[model samples]
Target: MLVKLGVNSGFGAKSCIYMLASSAVLRRQQLVIRCLGVGGYSNHNINTNQKPMQGVGFSSGASLEADVENVLRAITPTLDPNRHKGQAGNIAVIGGCREYTGAPYFAAISALKIGADLSHVFCTRDAASVIKSYSPELIVHPILEESYSVRDEDKSFILEKVLGEVDKWMERFDCLVIGPGLGRDPFLLDCVSKIIKHARQSNVPIVIDGDGLFLITNCLDLVSGYHLAVLTPNVNEYKRLVQKVLSCEVNDEDAREQLLSLAKRIGGVTILRKGKADLISDGEIVESVSIYGSPRRCGGQGDILSGSVAVFLSWARQIVTDENLSISSRNPTMLGCIAGSTLMRKAASLAFENKKRSTLTTDIIECLGRSLQDICPVP
Candidate 1:
């Protein structure tokens, strides 16, 4: 459901939300809404003609195309020769267990591919080496413990140890992507819950996806009112959120209103609802990135999005105070979702063009650079 944005006076009005549709309909149409400036309301409809995957430019007819372009350029950091290694972004993924490693790796590595300076993975020992073998670039920490590995008596000690390992570098990280391949081990999830609390306490932004969605759905307070938290949920996950929070079925008739209410009810966190068009909403405003992306619903695409959002959100947070940007929303989380959703759709379209039906998540990851370059060219 399409809805216009309303301006809110508060800085962190609500959470930014995006919904993705895993279908061919997502291939061409994209609409972006720029809710004027602070304390004012202006809605611009940037809808491209529905067509197959074309490169960066959508139908020239969409009037606000330049505004969308400006949003991406404004949030993305300029490459500087004198900057330190971690200046661009530092991202950590809190997931990966014996059964799942690729999700965390995808989430972590995508952050780097999208220009994050450093990417770290905190996972169980069983998955650490395998994920490391996947990429030597990642800094893998095998500190998490599943119930099977820890004695009942050691749970408390081990949990504190895990938190300590994370706390050492927590402040250094720009953002944290939680729940990539995190298995729902009672013990492991319990540990991750504490980690989430600490991240929140430290005021770090988090993008939650995959199994991470499962953890917060059951325990809403983990992310309940944190505006910096982003939840990326596909069809089923979105439905669950509707059930638990709104206590109703997925209301397609008034989805925009429902989404806005959901975000507000959850204490103003941004939600990216994954569907045909990536619909985003913070408690205060709702926006959409309807650009046509690939129809190939690969398993790890969401992981890529989670990682990409972490990087962009970090960048957005850094630039929120800059007076040069034209956009209105002071909410860095919303801007980050806009930038990340735009880039992901562009890369997906590019990958689908090259690999057709065989397109994998890795192919899309590889295209991130080219996509960013296309949108924000360097002088």
Candidate 2:
């Protein structure tokens, strides 16, 4: 006896098992099921051979790649003549402290170069002037304070003030890239925690990178269970995350499985494990973007990635319901990571083609528009 089951969409665990059993028993059975699309199961010659049946549905990997170019093109909004300012996108980067300011500047500016309508930076007082001087296009806020500058008696008042400052503009932002040059200052990290919580409440998407990963690694509750949150961790950061969450070292052979489990353990927050081929996972599915990038290994490229992810993530959210794409099973955060990583690599590759060993973060950022246009043209 052979049974056949046809499914239109992908099969769940229970449905998959049922189809397998039916195919084994009824050799000449055929069943048509309605899923997301039209796919059926058929078994021939069940009398002599009783073999386990194979189930076929859309593979998550296939779905991701199938729509990569389309997703990139769709999320990239067109430059309409009727559209005014801020319609393209408004991005905010939440990092930059005394020790480092270039990271936040790289992140905020990259958004604008990638065609975002507005880009803002929230940084410590010591870092604000430096970042502002780097680019007058960004709206820099010098509201954050380090503990060294605050009195013990004024900690509570100062904390509230910082929170208030961030809260004022939190809602207006489409997405926030947390941690670029964010140093691990106790006071500053504390304020960032509040800001993260507020962004959660406001339902704003967050892309965590650099020291932001450090902050979240220590305090998992900051982004845990938030579907809109994305974490971009380099080799060291990924190792730390694996150790912190899974209590084990990195397993190169099972990288994709580990990334999937890590995302699941973090309660569905998306993660982009940066490496030779960037691996992205959103708890349920794992995908890789292996487009060849620059070999220069510049310092601030991750900052560019975080900012680019923020813009793409914002754009992805805008097109979520535009079409019933086969890739809809994956979260938009995961899609954004895939598209952002691909674009960054293409830009880096293009920049490296010209600059070779001297390909800096700025050089790669300069190539973003051309790289994007190459992959997905406007007209």
Candidate 3:
């Protein structure tokens, strides 16, 4: 029987069987979400004062006037002695190349600081040692290959080897943070494409940012129609996506409508369009997290957002899908984006309060725990 074979087989064989079973379960989970729609827990008891956000120009807009702080508290699991490693979250960052290393480090480490039990970095050989030296906490794998190192004749073999390395641990990861410090090399992009495809096939949620946005923008089909996909695009990136998909520029006046259309065009994947006020939509409704962070235009903040989101979203997904957790919206991706954005902004504000104009990404990350505690105090 399949069960007997799985138990008797070696690690490789067992993993293959487990992955197949997990994929089937994930498909069923998505089916459940589709059936639930707006009939989630919030419908049972509506707050008269709190209003739902209506999606402008889209019939799917049942305005989700979500109390974000409540959603964050609802999803964050209590610290339990019964819980072991990887139970909280096991997140991975699929980036870090010769040209860039700090971005991936910021992301992978941010996931840990934000309460993920374990964090990992999958990068190139050249960047691995540097990334490892940055911190001893991360489990770093230098499995990625670029054009300079990969010869044309051996590209096929190298690509398979890279994918195999990731496949060994793919099923165990709760979420993947893609594109931070991921340089745009043709061969490297090709390999990353395969990884994204595999992740999509396995039904794992992915937070795409940095160069990852670049990859998905060109090939919208990679994330199109995949409900678990969350795209966190900054000003420039959002502009490109709007131009490419909707064939128009970013419309500030009709921001929510444009965002809703963009998500709809991409087959209902969630999008967090970052700016002074973060706008999130899943082609259903638009929600904004305008809690002011610092005015500092520092780099690497996006990495922090991406990593924080992966953990929160993973927790949100686990909680929502387990049994209807009490929250306004049913979409974990949207909730994750909201929580992550709110936390990031609060942390940034706190960091700026302390460091003033000198606030850096690390400073913001350090404020995450405190900001989270401020909103939802643990007993």
Which is the leading candidate under TM-score? 1
Query: Judged by lDDT against the true structure, how good is candidate 3?
Result: 0.79
**Cα distance off (Å), candidate 1, residue 40:** 35
Error at 246, model 1, angstroms: 0.4
Q: After superposing candidate 3 on the true structure, give the runs of residues whose Cα lies further than 4 Å from its correct spot.
A: 1-66, 321-327
Backbone clashes in model 3, listed as residue pairs: 52-63, 53-63, 53-64, 54-63
List model 2 lDDT by residue over 1-379, tens digit each. 0001112223353234223333322321221122213332221112322222122123545443334555566556656554445546689999999999999999999899888889999999999999999988999999999989999899889989989988887756778999999999998899999999998877788999999999999999999988789999999999999999999999999888888889889987889999998888877677777768888987999999999999888766554433334443435686688779988988999999999998899999999999888877767
**Alpha carbon lDDT of each predicted model:** 0.79, 0.78, 0.79
lDDT of 1 by residue, 1-120 (tens): 223477573553232221111111112111101121222111111122121212223344544444455577777766756345666778999999999999999989899998998999
Give the runs in model 1 whose Cα sits over 4 Å from its true position.
1-3, 7-66
Q: Better model by TM-score, 1 or 2?
A: 1
Q: If ranked by TM-score, best first, what sequence of candidates would result?
A: 1, 3, 2
Worst 10 residues of 2 by lDDT: 1-10
